[model samples]
Target: MNKPPRKKNPTFGIAIFIVVAVLLVIATLFYNAITEKREFDRQNAPEPTISSDAAAAAATTAKPASGAAQ
Candidate 1:
């Protein structure tokens, strides 16, 4: 039995390597960008506001009810 000669595809291998490297670089850039965005958001996040019910309760406590003595 005679086997066919093997083919050496150097270009294909190099192309694959280049494509993989490019994809890795792109993925790294995207990951870093997302991480930086999250960090920025965490740092600059707004302070939580008091709920309306809590605010109203506080207001009521601080000030006397209507017609109460001053």
Candidate 2:
């Protein structure tokens, strides 16, 4: 008895892989856009700035030793 021919296409598998890769790249770009928008919105929100005196006081408080002459 003669056996029938099998249909095996290697190009089909490569095409599927290429499609999945493109989808992943698109997803990454979408996710980056969302995160950047959120971060930009947060930056635009009102935030208090530290005054020079407050910054100086914080530095003094954080010092490990007194500023005595050696």
Candidate 3:
């Protein structure tokens, strides 16, 4: 006897598609957030201060040499 053909079930396929779509959307949002954060950091990064270097130079100059006595 010939067996009847199986009916295609769309429920599982639709569920998987929805899950994948949601995951993709979440991943895209996460990626966008990271990209925006990187851009913001690049734009708002602190400028290098020369005051520290100047302070170091001044300190070295102000110190008496080991060979010199006050």
lDDT, candidates in the order shown: 0.92, 0.88, 0.93
Question: For residues 1-70, could you state the per-residue lDDT of candidate 1 as single tens digits?
Answer: 9999999989999999999999999999999999999999999998767796688788778667799988
- Which is the winner by lDDT between candidate 1 and candidate 2? 1
Maximum-TM-score candidate: 3
lDDT value, candidate 2, whole model: 0.88
TM-score of 2: 0.58
Q: Cα deviation in Å at residue 59, candidate 3?
A: 17
Better of 1 and 2 by TM-score: 1
How should the candidates be ordered by TM-score, best one leading?
Answer: 3, 1, 2
**Per-residue lDDT for 42 in model 1?**
98
Return whichever of 1 and 3 wins on lDDT.
3
Q: By summed lDDT, which 10 consecutive residues of candidate 3 come out lowest? A: 56-65
User: Arrange candidates by lDDT, highest first: which order?
Assistant: 3, 1, 2
- At residue 63, candidate 2 shows an lDDT of 47
lDDT of 3 by residue, 1-70 (tens): 9999999999999999999999999999999999999999999999768997888788878677799988
TM-score of each: 0.63, 0.58, 0.67
